[model samples]
Target: MLPNIEIIVGTYEEFLLGYQLKQQSEEDGDQVVLKQTFADKSHAGSLKCVAVQGPWIASGGSDDRIFVYDMRTRKQSQILLSHSGTINSLVFSPDLTHLLSGSADGHMIATRVGSWKTEGDWQKAHAGAAVTHVSCHPSSKLALSLGGDQVLHTWNLVKGRVAYKTNLKSKSTLGSAPDCLCWSPDGEHFTLSGPLVVEIWEIKKAGVARREKTPAKPICVAWLNGRVCLAGLENGSIVWISLDAPEDEAAKNISAHEVRIKAMSYFDGTLVTASSAGELKIWSCDIEKQELEHLTSTNIGCRPTCMALLDLSSFKSECPQTSKVVAPKHTNQEKSNVVAAPKPRGVVTIEFEQDENPTIEDDDNSTTSDDTDSAKKSKTNHKKLKQDEESVGQSDDDDCEKSDDSIADFSDSESFGTDGFSNDSDSNQRPAQRKRRNPTPVGAKKAKPKQAKKE
Candidate 1:
């Protein structure tokens, strides 16, 4: 099973876009929290996009400017004026040294992290409509961008050149723009969500290898444990898919919210999904075994526009003499990664074999203590095995009807809700007063940090 989860909510008064941060956390699973609000100036347009580096939070608004804030000091550090249209998305390099900003003007700019100054660094990244989303490759020197032209473009970041470009044929049917793109952890596939359906594309040689559709219109996609793909659906449900399993493995759906799912992120084994209703639901997954368990669900009171995970180890190492003592070794392992059962190859086929009924027992009792432990483990495994059998049985029936449907079958009819802010907080309103609440420094929080609670 995946690890447990702790949730932090960024209760924003307005629709937020591009609000993501990279920081060190103090709490175990809930290390990162929305400690403060900076630059409430609504005039910068609708704070449409945000990106986080170690200590800096970079955000863009309708004002066609990029603003960088220092989280530690709780102050606006820098602002850059460049885009002619509203900024929609911002992405930071894996190393957090470079920033990429996408705007409605059909252009993208790459700037140094600390200083938003762009001299010879800016590149005309896209040609059609607006650049909707930008993603940096996990292990390669490449990056990908989705454009309003219904095309996916790949870039060679080091050479600053286009490597490949492919139009999303499924998107053409919707006659709308692509809004978001998510790359799988292994960089072998990616998902595009917008205007009804979530399309999964396998990275092929200069083209798409294969594509699959889901039931709900997807707004965000995240890789939970390098195996399963978690899709935040517009219908307030979170769908979990085991990529290793066949296309019809009965997508696991959890009713996570009452409104549209706006953003999602996964760390260790915990899945954090935010909705337009201002609720954040955390789900746990067993990636290898293709099982999902609902964990704690908390209402953050205000809509969460964006979310990100911050590793606590990075914070503790920064200070050694804090009064807050770190947890024991067991706690460290629990916080390090998502726990998933080892995936059984071809779950559908395995179910058939087990259902046929064949049982055998060994006649050895000399190793009594070890044998008892083995028996308990076997019992837990058997329960999970039975569940998979049922899932496969149900999926077989569902697949028959869906086979004739086109690739667009996954799209759903759902409209984006009105912006979460009140009528008084329209686009014309100037940015409002900023409220700052600095979190306790890394070493001054709780003691014997709680273990990430498993589902």
Candidate 2:
């Protein structure tokens, strides 16, 4: 059965095309038709990358802009100008609350979905190096990105900062960054594609679990299952690599195209592969049987840079949102060379930061007696606070009585006015008028009044 879904493609011709499978009478068979085509209205440059999630389809351009389209309304809804360079990649979180973008400017930004606001962003994610590709974990709590610096960054999505860094060249075998990176749906492993090689790294211990050499250099890759991966090769062929199989065993390979493959995406047993020669084909992928059947093919007549599948059947009227946009946290370890730019302030926000004076946690190796002593000390401090409060209240009352006595003593004293008489009428006495005098140094005689000179 054909899945109720559509594919959106980004082309070098500045055109974003959407295609859906249309079913006809049994005699005619299913057909692929162009559903929507958006041109020129978005950016003046070539479309570099694209992503689709829920009801929104977004295409990033070389002009440093991302145009968001409403698939349900068939209209251009929003445009994001967050990146300063060519947008390299775009991925929506599993919860559909945030759209994460990576650009050639070495920045990774996360934008909120509903309000269309930039929640938090890693200012310079790659330390002034361009981010080649990024993949979000199935849990959406973590992400992995490859950059021009040859480091693979494990981004803590909740903290909006790099959690760990690994050099792809740490091993002599995998000395260069891969062209593609994808997290397995199970979140246990991620596949990295390099020239004539594929590396599957385990997320548990952060090490390579499997490595297999391919017949041709891999250009793009998509996971067909937790253990099976489809790699599109530089020689225009697709190879099914099974991580469960032994290293010496040969995996399945098919000549998928006559030219180099540009990109690939898979969903619900359906695999879509695109060639740099402008051909798009859908295949029925049966991972359990280790079989791939060609279902249908279409020609966009224009070369595509990237493509993403938008499953209409999976659209949600309201998707679960990300709980909160976490502010970036800075630690002493952030001083590493892999560190990027500072926290955000406004629309591209990173409001909260680490405290200047951070409290340290108790060591796990502490003894029970030490814990008991700490508990006892806390109790003693609480008791002391209560005792101080009681003493303060008692002194407050005593001080109030002393103040009353002092007021009576002062009132009992007599007051004298300028008339040299003890007078009880203080309100009737007026202050004597004062004459202006010259400001002179001490011990100097004051100037006589001008009135004396007139007299």
Candidate 3:
């Protein structure tokens, strides 16, 4: 069973600053809910990046510190003064043994979990510009860094060497910046989005395989269900691309919000997207048709800059067994329903095998296009998972029926203010309303359909 969507809104006093949300529940088709909230106690900064590792939720702040908190206990766990400038990105290794962080000062640091000591540090990872993002390969041995230089640099952790580098070929005279990057689950390809286009590059070859320009600048992106990709636009919309389709096929656009989308992520088959206007929305993906349909929308009182998914399967396993309690005959249905509380879904485990040679192949013709195309087509033909809509709808209705419950209310809090921080009194206030805008029309020419051929 997938967890319900979780939303976290950040604030200072009464002004909203940022928000983070995750979509985990697929059976109920309900929108993401408010899971947690973080406010800058001193009104000094906002959250920039977030990483979920086991039971810990780590957040990078503009204050130049990485704050780790326990989700279940809702308490601050630890803080690392690891960066000299604003932290731009944070990622957990595949094994969740170490945390990697990049900052605006052009530094990247790997911190060991148990000792909280620096395992390795690189000061000039991106020259003078800030490292925009850092992603560990699914296998964990390689890491990819993207920055203002418009280049993707791959690093070999075991060998301590620069593995490979690639630059995007942009049509814009002003040049293009790689705003977001994501590797497919299988690690055969990676995609980059910037300016007005999202380009998918094949790792086996050194050239661009497919490109689709959107109407607005893309701020964030992620791969969903192996064969489709989701690009979140700065205009508060999302574009869904079918990688298995022809290159010229048009992407399906989903209307999510009216605020600029700053962060997004996918867990299981659910899509969670956040924006600057303090709105967190969740959607369910149709893997076969490559479509994303809206499920729920919640308002967190602050703008959200980053987000992640937490696996809570371990907690369920540790739950204490309860002895049966007598119930009145008239309440038998209620007692039975309570007894049927679903078991938590099993833990999500991803194993990483280090690649000795992390280098990108130099030969463009190393792999035949026919072979690549066939592989992609076969991957896309996977059977679609049948959704239990009736069960899901009933569960959602039951949740709604308990509207008086304190947990169901998801609105903006009064604690957020423009000062970039909040106080204890504000923390108890109701959340504020989210600002919304109509999505920009999908632009022509630049937003043209993608072609089928693999380049």
Candidate 4:
């Protein structure tokens, strides 16, 4: 059986020119096909961002256009215009009634989904710097935008103007500002991440709320489970942090990939991570142990920039017979909906060989092992294993409690004023605390050494 739901990944190419995740037969394996590879000639540039809602899929491009396609009809329904620079982010409001797209020119264009019309002055937001991310609040009445100016700007959707802003440069350092931001599921809090730091801020009714900090530079972030948010790092690791934990003890880091993680999404008990090197892996998450078990890894053969999952069960009435639209042989057909187990052949598969244990002969001068001590060691190991099994649930509950206490303390002790932007001069700037990782992965092929100069 094929998965009812499927994953769509956007790449550096023009629209409809990348891959779709699929599974092969039970005997074969899972794979990604370069299936959706055609685009209209009218669209003139590389795609930068994409979003899907119901049967409509919207994509923004370098040509400063937003193209909306009807998946059912397999045709472009609308081409939204009005931005002067590359459109980098397209996010649909939580209620699915509106769409927001932010551009390199530091402007955001909000469009009503039903009418495809621009919403008031949301067109020219973040006038000071390029908007890197735009996130919608759960209430659908407000939104947040993070820009190059190192400020967190909030917009009142109804009023069509900036409601409040906070200068985060003072809390961190200049030029080390946040590049990505995400709102918590409940919309009561949000997080800012850049080099060497992650800051979470509470959403208050007026002005600004409290802020807490942790020390990990995450390239992407998404809420994992209750109270835990997963942050993907430059080293290809995913750290699940509790919002209420103390800064130092908040994060549990798990090295996940060999290249820089570029995109991620979590649903049910599975977490999907994609790396810039074109590798994608699925893992079964254990929220109690704070551990992830590797499930399967697939190489999609292109650098994935973004990803989203649409549960098929929710749209079964709209989805055509997938077997007919997607050829059976071309798509990966599974035996059933079993959680995928790691296969022997993947881009980053590891194979280990075992040899027979070496036999050791003890001579008269050699040290002799004590049978009684060996028995004691075995008993100790047994007791430790039992304790570990019993403490798994207990430890998780205790950590949650401690985190709640720490968060409450921070909220009660912090304060924010209206004029919070920093004005320190060059002489007062702090030393650089973080640097970006190399673009290429380790062990990658390098250019041939240049010919030595003739003597």
Candidates in order, TM-scores: namely 0.58, 0.66, 0.62, 0.62
Alpha carbon lDDT of each predicted model: 0.63, 0.79, 0.69, 0.68
Q: Give the per-residue lDDT of model 1 (tens digit) for 277-379.
A: 8665655667766565665554556666666554332322222344877875656667677577898754221111254333334324345446555766898
Candidate 2: clashing pairs of residues = none
Separate clash counts for every candidate: 17, 0, 34, 5
Cα error, candidate 4, residue 360 (Å): 99
How far residue 38's Cα lies from its native spot in candidate 4, in Å, is 8.5
* Best-matching candidate per lDDT: 2
Compared with the true structure, what per-residue lDDT tens digits does model 2 show for residues 334-402?
Answer: 757565779985332112226533233433435644655676689789999999999977766565554
- Report the C-alpha lDDT of model 4 over 34-109, residue by residue, as the tens digit: 2343444445777677777676678887889888876555567898887888888888887788898889887787
How many clashes would you count in candidate 4? 5
User: Which structure is stronger by lDDT: 3 or 4?
Assistant: 3
Full ranking by lDDT: 2, 3, 4, 1
Q: Give candidate 2's total backbone clashes.
A: 0
Error of 4 at 108 (Å): 1.4
Candidate 1 weakest ten by summed lDDT: 407-416
